[model samples]
Target: MLFDLPDDAVLYTALLARDAAWEGRAYVGVTSTGVFCRMTCPARKPKRENCRFHETVAGCLEAGFRPCRRCHPLACGSGAEPSVAPLVAALEADPARRWSEDDVVARGFDPSTVRRAFKRQFGITFLEMARLRRLRESAGVLAKGGKVIEAQLDAGYDSPAAFRAAFAKLLGQAPAKFAEDALLRADWIDTPLGAMVAVSDRSALHLLEFSDRPALPSSLRHLLKASKGSLGLGRYAPTDQVEAELGAFFAGQNATFRTPLALEGSEFTRTVWQALVAIPAGETRAYADIAREIGRPSAVRAVARANGANRIALVVPCHRVIGSDGALTGYGGGLWRKRNLIELERGYARA
Candidate 1:
C-alpha cells in the first residue's frame, strides 16, 4: 500500500521538531534556497511558507530542488552508512578507475565489509556500483561513435575480451555488435532513483527498465532476438522523447507519457498492460481487481504475471498495483523503488 504522509501542518510540525521518524519517508524542499533536506537536517529551519514537503527524493528533484550538501539527502537508505560513505566519496572522485578488491584492501577496508555495507543500504555492492558507472560512461562513448577499443581503455579495462564480457553481461550484446544503422537503439536515462536503459525504434519506445534490474540482460537479449540483431547502442527519436517525458515525470511537472510505445506481448498480456495503464498515477489496484477489470475474474494469477512482465516501468504504471491486503507486491524494479514511486505519485494525485 502507498504510505500516506501527514498533512502539511503536521509535516511542518515534524520538520520543526527535527523528527527522525520521518528521516527516509519525508523530505523538505526550501523554496528560498532551492534545496531539499531530510527532516532531521541540522540546518536552520525555513519559514513555514517557504517549505515544500515531498515524499521522495524524486519529488524534491522534480520540483527543481537540489539536495542539501550538509544533510546529504541523496545518500542511500535512511542515511549514508559510515562504512560506505568514504567509499562512495572515492568513487565519485575517480569514477573511471577500475576498482578491485585489492584496492579496497590497500585502502585498509575489508572488501567483504564494504560489500555488505553497500548491499544493505543500496541493494548493490560498491564494486557493482562502480562497474555500472564505468559501463555507462563507455556506452556514452559508443553512442557518440567512438571506437570499441577507445571505450574499453576509457572504462579502465585492459583486456578487450574482459570489456566485451562485462558489456555483454549488462547489455546482452557485445560492444562490437552494436551497428551504426540498427533499427532499434538503446540509451541510458538517469533518474533520481537510478539509471534506466531505454530501447526504441525511430517512432516508438520498446523497453524502459532500470539498468540494475536482475532481468535486464535477459530482456535485452529477447529484444535483440526480436529485432533480428538490429539493436544498437544509441538513442532514437522516441528515446529522446521518452527521456524528456521521464524528466518531466520525475520532476512532477507532468504525469502523462506522450511517447509512443510498442507493447510486445500476447493478447491477454497486452490487455492486462492496457488495464495497468488505465490506473491513475496516485491510485492502486489488486491483481484480482485488474483481472475483473479485464473480464477475467479467474485470471488473477495471470494478471500478476502480466504485471511482472511489464518492462516499461513508470510509464506503464505497474508499480501502482498492490496486494489484495494493500501490501506492496512484487515489482521488477524492487519493492523499495515501488514504494518510492507510489509515494512520489501521491503528489500527482494532490496536484
Candidate 2:
C-alpha cells in the first residue's frame, strides 16, 4: 500500500522517483557498469531496459553483477557492531569458554552491540547462541563417532547433566541416545539460503528440511516414527552434497541437486510430493492442479494437507505450490519468504 501497487510496479515507480522508502525491497542493476545499486543509489540512472531490478543481493550476483562499493549492498544494520560477521566464525571455532564482555572488547566490539546483533538476527543472545551452536556440534559427534562423554566436553559443558539437559531441550534426545544404526540420522548442513537439517539412512534421505521450517518438529516427529528412527544432529551422504548444490541454486547459477532421497509418505502423499518436485524452478502450481496430477482430482484439500506435511522446502519444492487462484498460500516460512523464493527462482527465468 506504500504506493498502491504490486511490488514490481511500486518498484518501477520508486525507481522513477528515486524513492528512499523502497531501499531494501528492490535493487537496480545497470548492465553498463556491471554493478547493481540499492534503490536509493544516487548513480545516474540508465535506460529502463538497461536497469533490471532484483529482489536480493544474491540475485544481482547471480545475474553476474558485482556489488557496488558505494552501495555496499551486502551490509546490514542490526545492533551488531559494524565489524562482526567474523564473530560467528570465531564462535564456530571455539564455543565452549565463557565469552566475556572483556573478551568482546578485545575483539574490538561493543559487547552490548554483539548481544543485540545475535539476538536480532538469531532470536538468541550471543552466549545462548554459542551454547546452542556448540551443543549442535556435540550432537553431531554423538550421532557419528559413537561417543557421549567426549561430545559433552566438546560442546563446552563442564557437567554432563548440563549437556544432557541442553541436548534434550533442543533435540528430543539426549546425546547418549544418539544411535548409529537407526533407520534415520539427523544432521545439519549449511546452504546459501541458510542452515538445513537432513535426516537420512544408509540408502536414502528420508527427511531433508530446513532447520527453520516452523513445521520441522512436527515433520520430524511423524517421519521419525515412520522410519523407526531417533532424531539428533548429525550428517550423512548427500547432505553435504545438497548443501553445495543449494548454494549454487541460490546463487542462481544452476539447479544441480543430485542427492538421492528416501521419500517417506503414504501412496497419495508420495504422489503429491513427487509432483511438487516436478514443478520447475521459477514456476508455481495450483493446489487443485497438484490434486489433479496425482489422479485424485477431487482431493485438492488432501493434496494441500500433504503439501503442509512436506519436510523439504526448496528441495522437495513445496514453495512452488500456490492456491487454486494463484495466490500464495500459508507457507511455514511465511508468505513473504515464499514470494521471495519465487522471485529468486525467476531471476534466471527463460521463456
Candidate 3:
C-alpha cells in the first residue's frame, strides 16, 4: 500500500525490500482466490494483475476479500494497529455468545493481555465491551418496553443473576431496577478520544465523565450516592441533547447547549463551574478568572480545585481553564489531550 504518512516509512521500506513490516499493515488481495493474505503471507505472490494492496484489513474486506486461512489475517494484535481487528471480528462473529474468560483463553490469548489491548483501543475490556454491547441491545429492546425475560434471553444471559451482575457492573444498577422510562439515566458512550459515562435525570443532566479521566469512578459513585440512586440510563433526552451539541462543538459548528445540569457541589463550586462554562467554546480562562467570576477573587486555588472536580467534561468546560501565566495545567484527561483540545478549540475560534 502507498501509505503517505511518514510513520509508514518502515512499512514502505519493508514492502520494497520484502521485509517484515508489511506483514500486517499492508495486505495482498489475490484476485483468483478472492482472499486477502497478510504481507507475510507465505503463499507466492500472484501475477501483478492478480494482486491489490490495501492499507487496512477492513479495507480489504470492503474490497470483497475474505481472510486467507494460512495467514490467519484476522489474528489479533500482531499488526501495527495493535490488533483490534481480531476482537472486533470475534464480536461480529459471535455477538450473541456469552463471551467469557474461557472464550478468551480458547482464542489462544492471555485474557489480561487481550483485555489491556482491547481496553487501549476500545476503552473497555473485551468481555466488558461485549457486555456493554449486549446491554445496549437488551436495553434498546427494553426501551421499547420489551419483557424483562425477552431482554434477558436476547442478551444471552442464561440466568437472571448473571444478567443483573453484568448490567450492574456496566450500568451501576440491577436490570430489574432500570426505569423503563425514567426522566434520567446513565449510560456509556464511546468517542474517538475515550469512553465516557454520562448520567441524566429526566429534565437535567448530572454527570458526563470519561472513563480514563482518573477521578471518574469516584465522581460517579459520589454523585450516585448523593442523588440516592436516581441515576438510571444515559439514553435520556438530556444525554441526546448533550451528545449532539458536543458533536457540533467538536466539529467547529456553533451550537448552544440548553440542557439542565445537576451540579453536585456547594454554592462556590457551582459558581466556579458556571464560570468555566462561560469561558465560551473556543476561548479559555485562568483559575483566577473563574474565581473572580464567582466573586471570590482570593479563592483561585479553590476554583482550580473545583475545576478539577468537574464531572461533566466539555459541557462544564473544565478543560477550558488553564494554568495562570498562560500555561496548561492539571487536567484529568491528561495534559497532552488537554493541550490538543485547547488547540482544536483555538483553531475553531480563529476560523
Candidate 4:
C-alpha cells in the first residue's frame, strides 16, 4: 500500500490538510528534522521535499526518524508518557496510536530529555518501542486465530487494504492467507540487536531469528508448511524461557541456553546444528571444523547449508561459526550482529 500511495505533492497536500482519512495510512518522515508524523499531525508543515511518507512507524524508525512531538505520532490512545510503565501499558492496549512528544510534555515531562533517557535505557526511542508493541499485538491476535480484519483493526489500520499491505510488508504474507492452527507460537523478543522473533510451543523452541532477517519470511513459510499451518503468533513456554535466558546471555550473566529446541532439519543438517550448539559460548568454529565434527569432512558446503538452516539463533549459536580464513561469514541475523555477539562472548570469556 505504501507503493500505492499518492505522489509526493499529493501526499504533502494531505499532510498539510491534516486529513483524517489518511490517519493510520500514511506517516511522513521529515528529512530536515529527522522526525516522522502522521498525516493528521497538527505540527507546522515541513517543505514538500523534506517529507518522506512511510506506511508504518517501523519504517520511519528504521529510516532514523523520531516521532513528532506535537501530533503525538507514537501515542497509543491512552496518551501515556514515556517515562512510566503506563506508557508500555498504553502501547499494549492500543499500539497503533500516533504518539507525539507533546503527549510527554502534557504529562509534565521534557520531550528531549525523555528521548535521550529512553534511548540510553532501551537502546531505541519510545516510538520504535511502541511500533514493536503494535506489531506484537497484531501477531498475537493473528496467532489466536483472529480474522485478518480483527488483526488489522487491532493493529490500528483503518483501511483493510492498508492493513494488509503493512502486514505483508512486515511478515511477507497476506493476512487473510496467513497460516493458522499453529503447533508453534510466534512471539517477539527485544534485545540490543533489535527485535528477534521466536516461534515455539509448550515443549521446545522451534524457530528464532532476528525480525529483520531476509530469510525470515521463507523460514516461516517452510515451518508453516512443514507443521501443516500450525504456526501462529503468541508465546509458548519455550518462548518465555528463551526470553529470560537471552536477557541473561546478553547481560553477560550467562551464555548458556538450556531451552529445549525442536529442530526440524535433515539428518546432516541436524548434525551440523548440534555441532554449532557444541561450540562454546565464548568460542568460534569454522565450517570445515563443523563438517569434520559431523564426520562429513568433505561436505563443507552442506555443513554451511545446515548451519544456515538453523532456526534457533542465539540458542543454536550459529554466530559462533566463522570462515576458515578467520573472517566472519554469513549469519542470518546480519554480520554486524554476529560480530557483536562474538565480541560480547569473547569479552565474557576473558572476564
lDDT of 2: 0.66
Q: Write the per-residue lDDT of candidate 1 for residues 236-312, one digit (tens) a residue.
A: 89988887787677666788998899999999999999999999888999999999999999999999998999988
Q: What lDDT score goes with residue 80 in model 2?
A: 50
1 against 4, candidate with superior TM-score = 1
What clash pairs does model 2 have? 187-234, 205-262
lDDT of 4 by residue, 273-323 (tens): 888888887889899998888887899999888888887899999999899
Over 4 Å off in model 2, which ranges? Answer: 1-94, 97-128, 143-146, 227-236, 324-327, 334-337
Q: Which tens-of-lDDT digit does each residue in 11-51 have in candidate 2?
A: 66788787888766667767566667787776676776456
TM-score of every model versus the real structure = 0.75, 0.62, 0.62, 0.62
Top model number, TM-score: 1
lDDT of 2 at 23: 64
| RMSD values, in order shown | 6.9, 10.4, 10.0, 15.6
lDDT against the true structure, each candidate:
0.82, 0.66, 0.67, 0.73
Residue 28 of candidate 3: its Cα lDDT? 61
Rate residue 242 of model 4 by lDDT: 92
